[model samples]
Target: MLIGEVARHSGVSTRMLRHYDSLGLVRPTGRTVGGYRQYTTEDIRRIFHVESLRSLGLSLRQVGRALQDPAFTPSALVGDLIRQTEERLRREQELLDRLRAVEHSAPTGWQDVLRIVELLHGLNSSSAARRQQTVLTSAEEMPVSTDMLAAAVLSESDPNVAGALRWALARAGGDGIARVAAGLSSANGDIRQRAVLALAEISGDEANAVLAEALENPDAAVRRHAALAVGGRGDTAAVPVLVGMVVEGANDVDAAEVLGSLAVDATLATPIMHALAGELTAHPADPAVRIRLAQALAEMPGTIALAELRRLATDPDPAVSLIAAALAGVLEERAED
Candidate 1:
């Protein structure tokens, strides 16, 4: 095949084939009567091979080495290509996300676009202070998109920054609850905790509903935090977990306090009292459990809690008796006033 015929058949341009020839990548094996480059079957096959390698993201130099160097292995180069492609994809995805955030912000001018971009960069800064400052300044400068705030709060690890983000999310509340709810389903425990923390700060019914769902989360910390938040909202559904918290001694003091507050409701008071009393029955031998139960009884209100404390005051365990005696005396003193 002549040069033109080779270009036509191989789908490579004549100019590129000449360039390949100059690079010693492919050369015609024969000469025509007019001294034109005439390619043989073998040369045409090598041209196809070079094009195929190029399609796999191999550089021209890499293609030459692949074709000529017997020692040049494809495995290592292919691995590198895969890594390079992954990095490029990650960068592209990040850019797409930034563009979407900017687009969602609905910037009115190039200045608005610039400000949103700068604010986003600051929110993602490595320094916690910078992220916090960005959140603090966001409201004064302009309304940040809720999704952006949600993303920051969900992934933020720094306590101060996370608090600032959560506050901003609450103040900026549109779809914030829904976005944080997505974080509830994340595989990362820390992310889920952050999500619940943010949800707890948000005040609407939607946020409360998400907190209710989080009470059943597999992570103990998530469940505890959710229970505290929900119980604070006077959701009677949190009573069981709050009681379990008292039994397990996980934030038992705060859990006990919340349970006491829940007992203000007539419907929940007896059940809460029974749940606390039942824990003592379930673990009669554990003095530590008994002591914790006694302490919990002190936080509850009304004649029922007073009577339970009086009963516990005479218990077999001296520590339980002493604490219960002290708590009963305090309740008796308060009741007298």
Candidate 2:
């Protein structure tokens, strides 16, 4: 086949075939009287092979090596190609996210577009202080989109910056709840914990629903955070986790407060008291656990909690006995008042 025929037959352009010949990648085997480039069957096959490698994102140099160098293994080269392709995909996805965030902001003019872009850059800055400042000082005139704020909240590692992002998400209202909620399903425990923390700051049914869902998360930290948030919102579904938190001494004071608040409703008071009492019974030997439970019971309202507190007042451990006696007296004095 001549160059033109080869181009037409193999979908390889004549210029590219000539370039390939010049690079000694696929030289023609014979020539006509006019001295035009002529390709043998094997040469045409090599041209197809080069195109095939190119389609897999191989550079011309790599393709030449792949075709000519018998020592060149495809394994290392293919792995490298995979990594490069993944990096390209990640960059493209980030660009798409930025574009979507900009579009979601609904910029009215070039100035608004620029401001939003600037805000996005600050939010993604390597410096935690810059990210925090961007969130805290983001102009009311050009509010950052809820999606961008939620994304920032989910990925932010610095505590101060995360707090600022959460506050911004709260100010943005329930709109960012679903985006933040996506972090709850992340395999990373830190991300799931962040999602719950952000959701806790966001008010509304949607955020509350996500918090309630997170109460069942496998990560104990995630569950404790969600339980505290949802329990404060009067979601009784967090009762068990809150009780567990009190028993485990993980943020037990805050957990106890939330449990006490949940017990305000008359119907929930008994179960709340019973759950605390059950923990005390379950850990008979762990005096520290019992003391934590006793303290938590003091937060509970109604006669059930008072009775449990009074019973704990005589506990064997002097520390438990002393604290429970002090708390029971406080509860009794309050009842009289």
Candidate 3:
């Protein structure tokens, strides 16, 4: 193609192309016998890319240097582009901050949007991990006012999801613990279960106390979850209470889970062993609960436990049997040393 064709495709004027050629920035592939500059497909591509870079804010000098640099790897280019993106995000954040002062979006605004955008700009694996840390720290420091948690949980967006989780963690031991725990206890099965699982992260006596109080909720769902959370916490003080629930339990599913999660002592060991042993036999029909029981046994593997497992090795569910056998061997080996 000629200079005019190259100019049309690259959005550079013919005079600019001539100037670039004079500077040795880009030269025509050949010259026709008629003395017209003839450009190649490759030359056009280079011009297009250079013009794109210029549009993206790089100086023409920088584009020329980049074209000359043979040492630039694909990885290096990607890293440099990422750095540029982060810089842009920072500038955007500054603009957003100014906008916030001018027109407040207290409950909802461009400020939060910009914050999330900045967080995501250069989001590599390492950055994502750092974000997880920040989310935790920010949650701990910020008061979990209603709007914050409401935004985080309700919005399925990343910043919102992360923000909500962090806020939840921060607000964990607050008075809302009672209400949230109540939600866990009284909501539909899935919501209740999810709430209790999230509540697992909660710490301190205040959290456990809230859970304990939930046991007295008029709703049976609340009572069941309170039992599980207490048992799972393995606070030996709650052992008597948990054991009562175990004895009178209607939901063996929950019972097995709570028991399996418990960090039992030798005192509770005998009872745990009895319940687990019975589960390995009587509930052969309930594979799920049986697996949980086996897991608990594995956590406290011993000679008697190994003997029980050795028998199960040839049983119907090879997975359960094999895992039990493996735990027994590992425990025996660990003890031998």
Candidate 4:
């Protein structure tokens, strides 16, 4: 049966069905070919269990857990959960009793009535806030946020955005990285790219296999996202991937950015030196790529970096000439050291 039929047969509103879905309560037995939920008789019975529990003042959360292990019949879980339920009921009863007390007394003035109304509204708002918080806290325990990556990616291209994203990744508390991993091959290009970047930033908790596999992604953007995310970790595990990105230049622009990020670590000199040598020796097929390559080389200091700079000095582009000279000065300082 469809959701509407389930709602009618189960005497639970479609709204409650959606809420149940959100809470991992009763899922549809299957979906129709067109994607409408098709519920089984078993599904309807589960829906009633949820409704009966709710009627008993048990939270939907309580009902969801009960459905998880129906046969276990643990007195302890029931006792603890029922006690917590009683606490909520007692709080509600206290408010009702206060309201009754207020109603039993006559309001002496318009000001008194207004004050009473304000008190009632405040109580309702507080109660609603508590309910929402409970839902959020319980949902958070599941460790999967539908928008965890988007939350990390939005709002700014720099500073505020980057700071917020870094904080989110560094502080992420979930076994739910699978959500992003699942989105890696989404039909939408942007979603795929965003997940790639997220997985990259979250590289430490992530499996090494995921990172290694991402290096082979067909999309250059995704590949770079992986490279930058790993490089951001400053983990030596990422060194090999970064080295691979250096040689895999689908274009020189992205590879240069990767090296620039690598240069943020002084210990990365060895890998950056190797990449610079490869680019200088192979000679980039694009003039712009050649320029970015020279820029990355100019940013590093060493015999390899110096030799690459000296080679670029003879390039026809004047920009390359200027950068080579700057790299020479860096090499001269190395001699003086």
* Tens digits of per-residue lDDT for model 1, 1-337: 9888888888999999999989999999888898876998899999999999999999999999999999989999999999999999999988998998899888889999999899889988999998899899887876789988988898899999888888899898657788788988889988998988898888888888889988998888889999999999999889899989989999999999999899888888889988998998999889899888888888887655888888989999898899999999999988888
Displacement of the residue 189 alpha carbon in candidate 4, Å: 0.9
**Cα RMSD, model 2:** 2.2
TM-score, one value per model: 0.89, 0.91, 0.42, 0.45
* Candidate 1, run of 10 with poorest lDDT: 296-305
Instruction: State each model's C-alpha RMSD to the native.
Output: 2.6, 2.2, 14.8, 19.4
Off by over 4 Å in 3: 1-172, 185-194, 213-229, 236-264, 284-292, 301-304, 314-323
Best by TM-score: 2
Candidate 3, residues 191-290, lDDT tens digits: the string is 5544554454566687787776656655555566667777777854444444334444445456655554553456666766665677567667665555
**Over 4 Å off, model 4:** 1-170, 203-208, 234-272, 301-304, 334-337
lDDT of 4 by residue, 33-105 (tens): 8987788778878888788877766677667777687575647766876898889899998677555535543
lDDT agreement of model 2 with the native? 0.88
lDDT of 3 at 62: 70
Clashes per candidate, residues 3 or more apart or on different chains: 0, 0, 0, 0
Clashing pairs in 2: none
lDDT sort, best first: 1, 2, 4, 3
